[model samples]
Target: MNPLVSVIIPVHNGAHFLPDSLASVFAQEYRPIEVIVADDGSTDGSAEVAESFPGVRCLRLEKGGVSRARNLAVAASAGEWLAFLDADDRWFPRKLTEQVALGEACPEAGLVLCRVIHRFSVDIPEWFYGPTDGSAVTAYEPSAWLVRRAVFERVGGFDEARSLGEDTQWLSRAWDLGISHLVAEEIGLERHIHGANATGLIQNRRVVFDILRESVERKRARRAIR
Candidate 1:
């Protein structure tokens, strides 16, 4: 039997993009997968959109942040592996199949990351960016991840205190615990960049800085202990 994979999508007022994302999930070539749409108090019709899809489990929650919604979905899900997708992002048809293959090949890997292509809503001048910058930011997004449920549990899910950079914090904690990660060369995710993206919000910038500072301190403490 194929190992069950649970795909979790946490959204807040994401009705506009939820359908496309759900379609991508439904189009997956893999079998025995469950899709969990965690609606984080969306005033829009995000819950209705999620419920419109057959077999999709929609979990309604108060206006908690993305981390809280994801944590709740994972807690209610039953799967050996967990795959996360942002409401505005999409997975390629063979995404799950390829990730599963990679996981099987690297049994020691606790997490598998796939290459992602970022589609920007607006074009910027080529001269304005460097090779290391621009749409490459999607490289570190949680949407590209397929992780073992046990390892996720061991890392204690995402940090609810962080409104932004929660994925980074969670991954950092996982790495600190010596959890192995494998990167699949195949591009499996398409991240849509838009004006309203959380990363672009001014308040999230401060949250990002706080997360970075905490990460640096944790690293320094680990080094001192060693």
Candidate 2:
């Protein structure tokens, strides 16, 4: 089905990469799309960079967090489907085009995720690679996901309380409600991990592990209740 897809990009002091990310969104082969750049109190002139593009709405908000920035952008958007993109990442030309078609084919899917291509900077250690060849990484990344607008209202937006793993947490709630996901094999996003990414790559492995462990405990508690 052809529908208006609202692309929400949240940024904080990412003037260096916002241009590339916005360029990718503009390069999408899909039509009827709206782009909203949520600037989470960036000191690096990110708002100006986003405003340089025509037809792109730039939202100026306090330094709340990525989740808050995304939620605010979603609230301001006017699309039937919502797609999240971090300021430092980019989408392939057929990202929305392919995902939207896949969504139509899999009508039962609450969200559609495409295969992600990872690019690592020299700073990120080689041992951190998911695969030996480092061909790819997580499928649950928001950049790879195209979610239904209703999913947010149903499962609620990303957890503003938690600084990390909020996207995973929000998506898990939707999955627990029997909302299936359509993971498209087509590569449609380029995720950059430069020791620190707006998406999720913290150099401190222990902190990341703790965040994930919290999710696991919550999941076990839910299972126990059932």
Candidate 3:
């Protein structure tokens, strides 16, 4: 039988958190999942850290954004499901197992997202849920979502053109394809936020988010026309 899931982790100057991230992935309660770590021209020791793992496959790419690195990783991996994780983030032991169970329970659900606990620099922790969650939520943490391998191919993987908001844009495309999504309220991912985080690029945040919104709106409009 094929593995139930594949985990992709993109590393760029990720030496600082690679150990914890790999540990979290290796500790996953679920078995039969392969972990693919892609290094995007990291000058630091990120590649070395990834090599320390027993069953990890590492890919090297030019210095592109996270999206490009992820695309390369996905192309190199072979699994039924694709689960993306940032090198700076960690996952709960049951994250993969819970997501797989959810997929099995809802055959129509093409994507499964779990709640994420975001630790900010101010020492404050915030919980982010999916769109179905109440208005109190802040934003959707893309890393919390698990997608089918077919969905990735259908959407052409992440837009390499996008330096940010890659996750939102990809999900928007999935929504257009009549993909159903399930959200788990349990804390399944931990996103460590710091100054060096790529998503924090202030100049790109607004533009990327706008692109994401437009992508989603276009999908909604298409659905209405259908």
Top TM-score model? 1
For residue 24, model 1's alpha carbon misses the true position, in angstroms, by: 0.3
lDDT by residue for model 3 (1-226), tens? 5356889999999898999999998898888889999999999989988998899888877899888899988888888888888888899899888888888778788888887766655332232122322222222555687888877787678888887667767777777677888876667887776656555563445865687678778867988999
Pairs of residues at least 3 apart in sequence or in different chains that clash in candidate 3: none
Q: Candidate 1's residue-wise lDDT over 99-196, tens digit each?
A: 89999888899999887776767563342222324333235678998999989989897988878778878887888889998877777888787666
For 1-226, candidate 2 gives per-residue lDDT tens digits of 4799999999999999999999999999999899999999999999999999998999999999999999999999989899999888899899899899888787788899888777776565643545435575546778888998877688888889868767777776787767888877778988877767534444444545665676678779989999
lDDT-best of 1 and 3 = 1
**After superposing candidate 3, which stretches have Cα over 4 Å from the reference?**
121-139, 202-205, 216-226
Candidate 1 backbone overlaps, count:
0
For model 1 the TM-score comes to 0.88
Against the hidden reference, what TM-scores do the models get? 0.88, 0.88, 0.84
lDDT of 1 at 54: 100
User: For each candidate, what is the lDDT?
Assistant: 0.86, 0.84, 0.78
Q: How good is model 2 by TM-score? A: 0.88
Better of 2 and 3 by TM-score: 2
lDDT of 2 at 98: 89
Give the poorly placed runs of model 1, Cα more than 4 Å off: 123-138, 202-209, 219-226
